[model samples]
Each structure stands twice: as C-alpha cells, then as structure tokens.
Target chain A: MDRATLELKKSRAFLCLECGKCTAICPISRFNNSYSPRRLLADGLFYGADNLITNPLLWSCLTCQLCSQRCPVDVKFSEYMRDIRAEACRQNQWGNASHGGALHHIMEMAAAPALKQNRTGWISDNLKVKSKGEVLYFVGCLPYHHDFFAKDFDYAPLTAAVDTVKILNHLGIEPVVLDNERCCGHDLYWLGQLEKFDELGRLNLKEIEQTGAKLVVTSCPECALALKRLYAERLGGVNFTVKHISELVAENIDKFEFSEVPLKVTFQDPCRLGRYLGVYDQPRQAIMAIPGIEMQEMPHSRRGAICCGTTNWMNCDAVSKQIQHSRLTEAKATGAQTLVTACPKCQIHFRCSQCGDESQKVDINITDFVNIVASALEG
Target chain B: MAGKVSKTKKKTAKAKFVPNIVAFACNWCSYAGADTAGINRVQYSPNFRVIRTMCSGRVTPGHVLKALKLGADGVLVSGCHFGDCHYIFGNYKAVEQFDRTKALVKTLGLDERRIRLEWVSAAEGTRWGEVIDEFVAQITTLGPSPLNHKPKSRK
Candidate 1:
C-alpha cells in the first residue's frame, strides 16, 4: 500500500471491525452502490500500491465525518480517505474535476508565490474597510463565487465578505482587508496538492502577518478550519488566532439590536464548522437571539446532518444530486421558510442544487446567518 | 375569480399584454379536475397551457423555473390536495417541493404572486376553475414575465 495508506493501516485500519457502520451512514453511499468504508479500510491493509493508489473510488468520499460518527472502532474514514487521496494525487489519480476545473484552477493560481489577485471589486463604494488593523478579515474565494454563480443563481453568500466586515464595523472593529489576498488553500489541500497547499498556506500566513493582525476572522468555515486547524497541523503553528464568523458574532451578539424577523428557519451545520471544529451552538445561539424568529431542528442536524453535497468541487454527479435532494427535502420537511448556513460553500451548493431543474428547487431561502443578523441590526 | 384584469402601467409601450400561463396539472387529480371543469362548462379564462404529470410529486422545482425561464408569464402548479393524492404522499411531497422553490422564484425577479402552487383534486373541478381565473388575473396584473423579453434558451 501507499505511504498514507500504510500509515492509515498502522493506525486505525486494523481497528475497523468490519461493522459497516461507516458505509451505512455515508452520504455518498446512499446513491453510489460501489463504495463501502469498511471494505476500503480492509483493502488499504491488504492491497498493494497498485490496487490502492489508482483506485478511483478513493475520490468519492466527501470527508464529511458521517462515517467517523458511526464507527465502532473510531476509525476516521474521511480523514483516511483524504490521506489516501493525497497519495492518489501524487500519482496523478484523483477524482474527475467537475465544473471543468474552474474552481481548482483558481486555487492553483493562488499557489503561485508572489501572486497578485484582484479580489476586492465586490466591495461597494459605500463600505469602508480598513487596510490595516488588529483584525484581518480573510475573504476567501467569495469573488470567484460571485462571478461563477452570478450568471445562473444569486449566490449572496459571496456578499458575506462585505457583510462580515460591516458586522465587524458595527462592533467597532475595522478589519484589515487585503488587496491581493490569495485563495484559502483548503480545497487544494483536500485535493492532495500538498506542495501547492503548502505554498498558499505559507503565502497567506505571510500576508496576514504583514497586516499585523492578531485575529483572523472569516465567514467561510473552510478557511477558518484551514487557518485554525489544518495550517497549524501542517506548519508547526501560527501566531494568530482563527475565528469562524459565528464565534466572532456569538461573543458580541447582545450588543446589536435584532429586529423581528418573523420567520421560521433551520440551520445547516457545515461539516467544517460543526463536526471538524465542534461549533454547533454558536451559530444556533446567534440566530436564536433574533426576536420573533424560531428555530426548528431538522431530523438530521449538527454532527449527524448530511452534507450540502459536492465537496472540493469534485465528482458532482447523480449521487451528489441525491445528497442535495435529500438535504433540501430534510430542510423542507421542517416547514421553515428559510435555510441558513454558516459556510458560503454550503449556501452555494444548496442554491446551485435548487437551480437547473425547476422541479428540484426548494422554497427555502439559503443564506449565511450573518446577512440576516446584519439586516436586523438597528440603523 | 376575476377574468379581465387591468393591465399594469409599467408595460404600456410593450406588445399588447397577453400573459402566458403554464399549468402543471398532476395526472391523477389536477389534470382530471381541469378536464372535469371543461366538461362542466366552468368558463375559466383560456390563457392556460396545461402540462400533465404522473403525480403532484413529479412536478419538480426545475419544471417551474424552466417554464418561467422560457418566458411563461406565469406558472400555476396545481396538484392533488394534501393526503388526497393517488400516489400515497405525492401531494404532500409536491407541497414540500413547492416550498423549496418559493424562495428561489422570489429571488429570480419573478413576483411571488406570479407562481401559484395549489392543491386541486380531481373532484374539485370548480375549485380548479376558480384557481385558474384568480391566477390568470394575478399574472395579468403582474404584467409580462421579466424573462419574456430575453428569449435566449437557458440550461
């Protein structure tokens, strides 16, 4: 087996009791019949590099931690799959790129040293953003989301970058807005382009350090997760503290006046925000603070909730559609008029799924809770 | 249910206002209800282009958006009343699906009033007639669909 596969085998591969709980809860396996986590772990132990490295089934996992939640032996199937994907990527055997590598190409471009990106056009004339401050608001890939999803659907989560800054300003914070901010290397790292991931990480850190910012806040859970956990895991540690916008807002939620929203809504806990970092209550607490708005719990939420379907922009197919279908249906069944998500990726994925097929669209409004809270803030 | 709705002032200079309404009638209930309405001489407006489906659940949000995107001045998704579907949960599922698309339609510059989702059973032919009249009048007041002038096909 490959090095990553071998490492996984030495760690938890032997611990898997062939219980098949991972496959039972895996979202991908719901539509795809070919995959089973227990079987894959077993194969990782017994199979050689030839059988393990080139197996395209390695890319199907969303790395969403549903399998790990059910694992009797506590084998982290998603993490192991990510490691395996790194090995596969090293051998140039990766999942087929969806959207014609439009997103991947953008992340890859960020990997270039001394990279210059025009990321601030989305900032309107009225918004005042500080160039230097103790707080550096990391606006990750929202510009790309704006341009990419604008033609078909209104991906308002992209505006969370601006709204995040506005919310910061509301709390008497002037966050440092980087002019040439690079794309957060979360997707690339997951895609197993370790060298590129490393380069972007180092570059992003260097940029943030130059801003003299002690705190790095981002609306995207993926960026926050990458900066807080993954970046530290890869490169010893960093000086700055990373906070997902929920944590940032949750601290000062009482300071703002919340107008009555008069709407029932459900929240989709993005895997990065919930399962990975254990930020389940912060978002809910923030939303619940709004007067007259009620929170209805979906049947599957928090750690057990399904993904918005399609991760790393890879292998978006019928299975991904089914997962999206199931998730929207779950939210719809709750009878909430809106579906709120912390992560922009989740918002985009859910909204995109609602597009193309008119019949597939859900009536639920999808947006970052920050925007709603921002709307409710007193003038 | 009114028929002759006053044309809105916003589109005065455009082609004489004729609202195109696409009705997704479920095969079991709404479609048969429309046929029953015709047999009973319900005398509803002639603005509807009805599309029949196997069940109310089969009318996905994509179909509604496609009709609107293709310049259907209005889309009327009529299904079997809740729990009255020929398929056990089709109407319930259809209502849920409609809820899913409601926010989306509002976002796409289509008036929430333009797209009407109703539970019309095969037995309620008069109800179907009334709904058609109400919706046609609603669309007439809303004027031409924003997507009407942009005739290019979209995916």
Candidate 2:
C-alpha cells in the first residue's frame, strides 16, 4: 500500500465514528465553520490520498489534539494530520506561512552543518552554566524570538531562558548550555519538512551527546516534546532522558524558598505540553508551590485546554486571532491578573491578539510560567 | 583526448565568477535612482537584479532571507535616507527589520556582510552606481553564498 494508506491505517483514522465530537471540541472549528476534523477524516477515507494531499483545509487543523482527546473511537487525528502534511509537503503544497516565512527560513538555516551561533550571549554572569554537565538545558529559539520581537512587542522571551538557568542554579545543578545548539525542529516537523527536521534533530542529538548529558531539560513545551519524544522516534532513539523544566522544578520544589508573588494567574496549557506529553500537572505544581500566589483554573484546563491559536507559525489568520481572543477572554473571566503559560509561543500569540484595535483588545498580562516561578525565587 | 582536455581548460579559464545579488529598492528613491544611473549612463556592475517595493518597510527579513536561501550570493536593501522617507517612518521600520535579519543571518553562519542596507535618494545617480559596484566587488571577494547552488531551470 501507499504511504498515505499506511499512515491512515496506522493512525486508526479508518475507525472514525463521525460523532462530530472532534469538530465540536475543536477551538478552530468553533470559530471556523469550514474546518472540521471529523469531515477531514471522512474526506481522507472517501476521496483517497490525492484529494486529501491538496486540501487546503489540511493546514487549518491546529493539531492541538482536542478532537482526538474527545474522540470515542480513539482515532489519532492530529498524528494523521501530521503524516498527511508530510505527504502534502512532498507535493509542494504548503500552508500559508506567517511572518513571510522568516521563521521557517530560520529553522532551515539552523539545520546547516556549519552553523556557528552566538546563542549564549543571554547567559548572565550570575547564572552559572557550564560547557558540559550531567544536565543540559535546551534553550530553544528564545534568543532568536527576543531579537525578532524586540522592536514591536514589549515581551521579553529571553527571560524564560535566563530564568530556567537561574532556577537550575538555585537547585545546585549547573546545567549545560551549548552555544552551537541548533533548533529542535519542532516547527519544521509539524510543518512536514521532515528532511530538514531530521537534519536539525540529528545535529541537536549529536551536540547533546557530546555534552555527555544524561538528562536534557527545556522550558519550551515544543522543544521538550521534540527533544523528549519526537527525536527518539525519528532519530532512532536519544541516549539521554529529556525532561521539561516544570517537571524538574516540581520534582525538587522543596529545595528552594519562594518570596511572595501575591498575584492571581490562570494557566494556559500548551497543547504540546498538556496533551502530547501529558505534562499538565508539573507546571501547575511548580506555580502553586510559590507562596502568596493564587492559581485559578480556566474553564477548559488540563487535557481540555484550548491552544494559543497558532501552531508551527503558519496559517495565522482571523481564525487564529478569534481563537486567541476567546482564550484570553476565558483567562480574563477567571478573574486572573495575569495569564501564565509554559510555552513562549503562547505568550507571543496571546500578545499578538491583544495588539488589535481597542475593541478586540483583551486587558490581561501574559507571562511565561518560568518567569513567574523565577520571580518568586528567593536569592 | 588532448583537444577535449584543452577545450575544457579554456572554458574554465574563460568563465569569471559572477555573483548573483538580489537588490530590493524602494519605489520612490532607490528604484528611481537606478533609473537615473541608467539615463546618465553611469558604469556599474550588471550582476544584480532589482525587486521594487512601494516602501523600504515592505522589504522584510523574509524577503532578504528568501533571496539568500534561493542562491543569491548577497542581498542589498536600498531605501530613502532616514528622515527623508516618503512615508514618515518607513525607513526606520526598515532599519529595525534589517537588524533582525542580520542577527538571523549571523546565527545561521552566513557572514553578516552578505546583506546590506543603504540609503539612496532619487537624484544620486552616481552614488547608486558606486553602491552597486562596491557591493558587487565585496560579494565577489567573499565568494559564493554557502547556500548557493545552480537552481533548476523552469520551463
């Protein structure tokens, strides 16, 4: 059988019940009537591979796994979408890339074998990071985002990276930060540029291997998922154990003392962290461990969380804005002063949604969960 | 066999390395400046291609990166002088975007000199020629872009 057929069988999309639960639960489908995961599956099954490969709606799916989570038959629609997107990429049918595809180009460039990056300029003198260690902190694309968004947005994404190291230092573990580390290729993998993704993955795995790190940790959910799960699956398995910083923080919450934050915040569960990696609790545990901080759960929290509206930095349109606006509104309705999220992309997207005209603006601060935890750290 | 070998050697010797440079010129200033250079018959390197945009701000990091990725040896972004922008602050915006683009290019292991930003007013015909000649020479000295390859010819 062909690759599409084989992926279809492997994803179990053939057993779709047409219950419309995936559609009803989808954050995109709620706003975009044209997009439905159930219908996409039906189309895949009935119309064969050719039609499915060219379907523009294929890119519209957030792959947030909201549908697959609610599906009765347990069809992995998101994984199915990923596989089909790989085929679509081979056919040169790409989604409408956002930011004029600059981010994608950055990822492609990161895959270059001779790439020498000054990525460690952000590492302050106080935060002790070694060239190699038992634990490696994967600072994925935060420094790049810092420069890219510096002119327009007030958000400081680099804080998340710095804070992750700071927290690690407080725990008495000086993590390894590689200056020559390439991107984790999470965005490339989701965008179906598998070859470039593999190149980046191999480069990263090789670098991490050279560090002799038995444990890899990252603050970004996408990076964590890529390093912890996707790399192993695609690159024939990584030798080190990968952990999100939240997991590490939660595991050793008692070691450090916290100063009073005294802020009310609601958590935004990044789709990769919560659904893909099942890391819903660790971030919350770390957040709650902070003294004088109150955590309010959004209506759709944990596995049922709504995405930050855009993924892979592609297809960010009115539908994405509406999804972000609604998610922000939900956070605001929870009576929280700030919206805390584990992923840097979530903070970026949320802030982008608020940049609209006054009517569309939601008045709530968006911050990285790591930043919050770092602020509470007692030096 | 001796004749064929000599012919190949002559061909290689005759072919001088010509760099493919992508130039983004503002419609109001740099594009008009290039036209002025042509009308004045100013001598300059002919290795660059100009893509005109309404404003310098329109030449985003994506455009610059795309040019390099698609095998351009270098990229030149020409705009109006800072305070003289047709649109109040479009040139300023271009500066911001160019800075970000340079950071990305540097991180990706490309020499930051491969991309440049300059200001050329509509009347600077001689200056336009000078800019092109200098950039072309610089790129030639730097050699071909690492990403450069013979792109597939389209029918």
Candidate 3:
C-alpha cells in the first residue's frame, strides 16, 4: 500500500468501530456474502490492502449508501469503500472481468457497424434545426445497451426522446443529440477503472463541447448525475448546466396542461437521481401537475428509497435480481395502479422482475416522468 | 549515621514522582458535571488535565494515542451515556471505536488499563470526581509508561 493510502486507512480505522450494521442492512448481501462494509474496514485496519485490493467483494457493492445512513459514528463507510476501490485501480490491482466488464462489452457493441447503424440513428423528422443548439440531450448507453429504442412500445423510447426535441422546440429550445455519444464514464468510475474513466470522460467531454450547447439535458439519471456532478467537478471548463428532462419539463409546467386522466400514479425514486443527487421534488411536482393523476408514495420513497438493483456500475445479475424482487414487492404494496421511475436502469430492472408475476400484478410504466406530463398536454 | 540517613531520605523524595493525567469532557454533560463538582467545592487531586469536545463521538482514537505519546500517563474519555448523546447515537459509535483502539493498544503491549471510558451526565458530578480520583490513584500506582522505557525492534 502507498503511504497516503495507509495513512487514510489509519484515519478511517479510527472512525470505524466494527459495528456490523452496514453488513446486516446491505441489500446486496442477500446474494453475496463477500460484500460487507464492516468487514472492509476491519480488513483495511488489521490486515491492510493485501486482502482488500484483490477481493471480488469490493466491486459488488451497489453504492446505494444504505451503510452510510445506518452508521452510528458517521464513519462514512460507503465513501471509504469507493476510495479503496479507486486506490486499487490506481495501483493496477484489478482482476479480470471486473465490474466494468459489461461497460467494456457495451463499448465494443458501439464500435460494431450493425450496432452503430440503428443506435441513435432515429431523430425527429421535423428537427430541421442545425447541429448547434442551445441544449444537448445525451441519451447515454441505455438506448444503445438495452436496444431500448428498437424494443417495446412502438419504438416509443427513442421516438419520445425525438418528440422531446420537438417539445423543446415548441418551448423555443432547440437541443442537439450527439451522433456518437459514448457512455458517460459513470460505469467505469463506479467499477474503479480510473484510467478508462479518465479516457472515456475526456472523450465524451470533448464530443459534448463540440456541439457548443450551453445546457445539457439527459433522460438517464446516471448520465445526468455523472455529467452534472462527476464530470462538472473533475473535468472543469465545460461551461454547461446538466438537467434531467423531468427538471426541465417541471420548469416549464406552465406551458403544458393536464387533461385529468384519472390515473393513480406512484413514483419510484431512482438511486442516482434521488439519494445521490438530491432530485426528489422535480419529478413529483411534474407528476402532480398532471390534473387527475393522484401521486401516492411508497414507505421507502425519495431519500430512503430502495435500490432498483439494476445499477450499470456492477455486473452482479444475481444480486441485482434479489434487490429488484425486494423493491418490486414494496412498490406493489403501495396500492398504486401505475409505477413510474426516472432512471432507465430502474425501469429495466422493474420490468425484468415484473414479467414473472401472474396475478394481481401492478401495471409497470417505464416512461420518463417528463413523457407523462408531455402526454397530458392538450396539443 | 545521621549523614547516611539524610542522603537516603533525599533519594526517596526523588523517586516519589506523580503521573500526569489528561481527561476529555463533553461540553453538554461531562463539562457541566465538572462545573457542578467545582461549585460544590468537591476537593479532588489536580492531576487531571481536562479538554472539552462537543460530543463523545468526537473523542477519536487518534486523540487518545496523541495524548499518550505526548507524555500523558493516563487518558480519561468522559461523555454522555448511551441514548443521552445530544446528537443521538453518537456515543455508541464512540464507545465501539474506543473498544477497538483499546484492543490495538493491548496487542502492542501498552497499558490499555490506563485509558478509561466513562459516561458522566450533567447530574453525575459525584461520579465524575470519583472516576478521576480513582484513575489518578490507579495510574499513580501503575507508574510511568513502558514507552518511556526503551524502543523495541520487532524485526
């Protein structure tokens, strides 16, 4: 271990008290025994990095921050794990098929001509505006990774995104979509591949800057969070504000009116959007602005909301499924007719889990919160 | 015979050295308790040196080690009892952390007994004095630290 890393561990060890609260409450631990925040601190303190760096448990964390909240001493155990993982990557101690392996797979897919042909190829027919617009909508890796645009609801995901451009145009806001938008490097950073993260962040930042847009709007919460927090602070000099589409639509609710559709809707707070970035009210306000859509809340909504378990940061499908099942059970218990979430990951996770239910199944709507408000428009 | 007796008495006087103690008192509970002790004019040994922190959670292991390394014979960590932390549940974390540090000190062959953790509420002025008096007497009997003896090479 480096001197600085040792000193940090020493300092952190003083804060941690081996209170097994983190390990007990973690949602991922239902599947993987190796992922324990308490164990990580103890190992770091007593045994040092010889055990921590190579352990597969480090990357398995959902970064849901449940541990940090439960900690009595304010040890900041979750951030410590992140720092440890980051250090492991810094020292080139990563194993094969790391957390970012899926991201690498997706990046490879992006390079394929067949994959690139359909990905992000769809745009509004009426978008005759030039490539340079005041706002840029970064669709992120989801529309490409999940083939979301091609699958489901009459190609509505991509079309709605295009329609979003039209909606923005109607609001006197012409937004540009990057023809070659790459993954926002959140996956790489979360995976502890700092080198890849740096390379990808620089590449994405360069491409985004070329559009000359003053503001960037994203439908993906992860992409929005990464761009707004990580990219803004780390890769400075990119003078732009990153807003989620729901935030943007909520800002312009005066321009849209609801038709009183009499739908009971409940919103699931995406981990990145709500807990990580403090975006609770914007989506709710947008949803409530729709006249007849009564918004009910789950017990664990907003800050304390459960993870949807389909984080792009980790490749643990087994753990993700376990988390998904738990969250879906809670969502169904809320007695709401329709379940709406902001993140594409949350939508994908919930949809995958909801497929097996045969009876008393709640209708799962994967539409962006903004799309709902946009649909409510009288135009 | 008288000259020999005088020389031996001088040597005994030189050997009778008292230990220096540092005590950490919380602003809410322990500090007020100490103030109560003073107001009541409860006479105790002036061996203890008290430093005030906002809460018991702020009493880090580093503070303990730093005090010991800087020639404090004993360290007294006093705070509000469990569920009494003004910040709520901070003392639990503090106690847990202190226990682990105590274990580390034991492994290093240092006198972990010299370091004491106590919960003294504002009303527990008598308990505070009793704790300090007992620690001072105990440390005075234990004498100076082994760290002052000689540095050992484990390698």
lDDT of 3 by residue, A185-249 (tens): 78666665556666667777877789888899988788887888887656775678888888887
Residue pairs in collision within model 2: none
Candidate 1 lDDT over residue span A1-379, tens digit each: 3477565763466687888888888888888898777778888877743466677777777888888888878887766776777777877886777755656755665554533455676678766678887998998888766655655586654668878878888888888888877777888777778777888888888888888999999999999999998889887699999999889888888787778888899999999999999999999999999998899999999889899898898888888888998899899899998999998888888887888778767667887877878877742
Q: What's the ranking of the predictions by lDDT, best on top?
A: 2, 1, 3
Extract clashing residue pairs from model 3: none
Best by TM-score: 2
Best candidate according to lDDT: 2
Residue A40, model 3, lDDT: 75
CA error at residue A188 for candidate 1, angstroms: 1.6
Find the 10 residues in a row with the least total lDDT in model 1 chain B: B1-10
Give the lDDT of residue A294 in candidate 2. Answer: 94
Candidate 3, residue B140: Cα displacement in angstroms equals: 88
Model 3 lDDT vs. the true structure? 0.70
Q: How does chain A of candidate 1 score by TM-score against the true chain A?
A: 0.96
Give the residue spans of candidate 2 off by over 4 A. Answer: A1-3, B1-17, B82-89, B149-155
Candidates' lDDT values, in order?
Answer: 0.79, 0.89, 0.70
B1-155: candidate 2 lDDT, tens digit per residue: 97788787777656887999999999999999999999999999999999999999998888998898788999999999988899989999999889999987776778899999999999999999999999999999998787776644332
